[model samples]
Target: MKLLLVVSNYPYEGHPYSGAFNERSALALRRLGHEVEVLAPRPYVPRGLSRLASRWSSYASIPEHETRAEIAVYRPAYAQLPLLGGALWSESCAYAVSAGEIARRHRRAPYDAILSFGLIGAGGIGWRLGRRLAVPAAGWATGNDVRVAPRSSFGKAVRRSLEKIDLVFYQSAELRACGAALLNVAPDEMDARRHAVLPRGVEEPPVLSSERRHELRRAVGLGEEQVVVLYLGRIAAPKGVFELAQAMARARERCPELICWMVGAKRGFDDSAKLARCGSVRLIDACAHEQIWDYFAAADIFAFPSHGEGMPNSLLEAMSTGLPAVAYAIPPIEEIDQGSGALLRVAPGDVHGLADALVSLARTPERRAALGRNGRARVYAAFLSADRMASAARRVAQLIETRGVSFSQFADRSAAAVRR
Candidate 1:
């Protein structure tokens, strides 16, 4: 089947770390013998505006089109309004731009279905484009689209999109429940039939021998006795970056050999001042996605104290590299844990608990080794297996072939039947 993925964030030349999972999904679908293409709308800002903000300049620099990882990615320019943060107006502009490009492609060789990576921008764009092109469309909710966006000013818009989308794929069951709640439907209702829980998978990393790990640690300026705790993601409050920093500071007092390495883009949230003050905490800027595995190999523990998540790719990647994780006991993380002891869990915002967990893992080498092995096994069995992506692709193909009406339309018909 031929499919078009409408995504707001996609890895580009300059921002290779952005949307790494989306890239992986597209590649996986292609490997399953499906023709997949990506349409990611790049924000367009005038040169004058670009001069004012380096962010805008970076956006302006993205080429109109590029083939990333051997997959065709079309990036059309969409005007970005200042302070709008890609809200309704930005989405409208993106839709207008993407619809035209997709229409041309559809005329040449029609796509089977359109899939959006998230709801706010890409989902709406995909639904609208699918309607205009007479194709089925589905939405994949990755965290914020369900939990955060619905409570913001985009609530009604999101509900409307949720109703109109043919199917909704959530990264976790908890996120699926959140999406159902947004639509005001019970778990066993029409929402259940129209939605699925499909977690993203991580590619297996090269096996790191003890010698290789020790070499990597030495390359990164780590002593043989030092313990490394790694965090890779955006440096933001919601990601618990500040909390991780504070926890590291507290943990170091107990385990003097402990070192914390926070590697990610600051984006808008700058925790440099806070992280700088914390001794033994190293803030490394985000690097290429391919280079991330080395950091995981050199680290003994992965710390992700995020406040919320929809199946984090970093956590999966870390675990895939045989790194035991320490994260908050949020619903998504708990779902991943499933009492498997694959990761050590702490209460959300419990800096002391987080610190203690880190210290305990640092002090107990045998427990760390056991948890790392368990984490790697869990990741492979649950997420890295080929069956996961193949099943997802088969479901998408089924949706394309069988699902024609939107979820809301089906719900309305069911309601009328009950009334009759």
Candidate 2:
């Protein structure tokens, strides 16, 4: 099958971590013997305005086309205003600007199906294109689109998009319910045939010997005796970086040898000054996805106090590396844990509780080892990339086969229902 994946976020030049999960899925689909291509509409900012800010500069720098993991990725430029509900209209802007190009490509060689990530943004593009091309379209609902976007100024866009796309894949069951609520429908109304969970997969890491682990720690500037707690994600407020800084300070009061390393890009929420006050926290710039395993290998524990998530790849990667996790007890996190006791859960925004959880994991070697074992087992047993992707490929095939026959009729009914 030939598939077109439309997503707003995708790894681009100098920003490899961006949209990494979406790339992984495309690669996985390709590995399943399907021809996969990506349409990632980058936010366009002119060269002069780009010079004024790093954010705009990055957008201006994106190449029109690039190949990642042997898949062709086309990045068309779209006008992206940074203010006044620009985010809510990004999908419409992208579709409006790039639809002709997409139609031209379809005329040359048609796509079998279209898959979109981020329901309100990319999903709109996919739904519009799928209708024009008369192909099956599936949308993926990640955390922000369901939880955060629905509460924003253009929140209704999410419900409208969800209603248009019949097949929606969620990162977790909790996220599915959240999306269902946004649609003003009971969770059960999101029938199994229409909605399902398709989580991101973590590749299992090779076990490191004690000597190699020590070498990795020293390479990252950590001492042999220090208990390392690593946080991997965007250094933004919603990701709980500020709370992490405070929690690290409190944890250090009890265990001075506890060292926290926060890795990844610094976003709008700059916590560098706050982290400096913490003293024991080390802030590392985002590195290639390939290099992250070294940090996972060196860490004694993984800390993810993120306020919200749709199956965090970092937490899963850390667990796959046999590292214990201490995280905020959000619904998605709890759904991932599934009562396995593989994680030490703390209340949302509770700095002291976060500190205690960190201390508890840092001081107890036995508990850490046990949790690590459980986490590793859980991830390998159920969350391997190959397994998850294989399941997703099968579902996509089913959707294409079924939806192709009745999409026009379904569209008519959906339009009538919405009008009524």
Every model's Cα RMSD, please?
5.2, 4.0
Query: How do the residues 196-277 of candidate 2 rate in per-residue lDDT, one tens digit apiece?
Result: 9888676657766778788887776778778999999887778998888899989899999998889985543355555555
Against the reference, the lDDT scores of all candidates come to 0.81, 0.81
Instruction: Provide the clashing-pair count of each candidate structure.
Output: 0, 0
- Give TM per candidate: 0.91, 0.91
The weakest ten consecutive residues by lDDT in model 2 span 411-420
lDDT score, candidate 1: 0.81
Q: Candidate 1 — which pairs collide?
A: none
Cα error, candidate 1, residue 226 (Å): 1.0
Number of clashing residue pairs, candidate 2? 0
Error of 1 at 5 (Å): 0.7
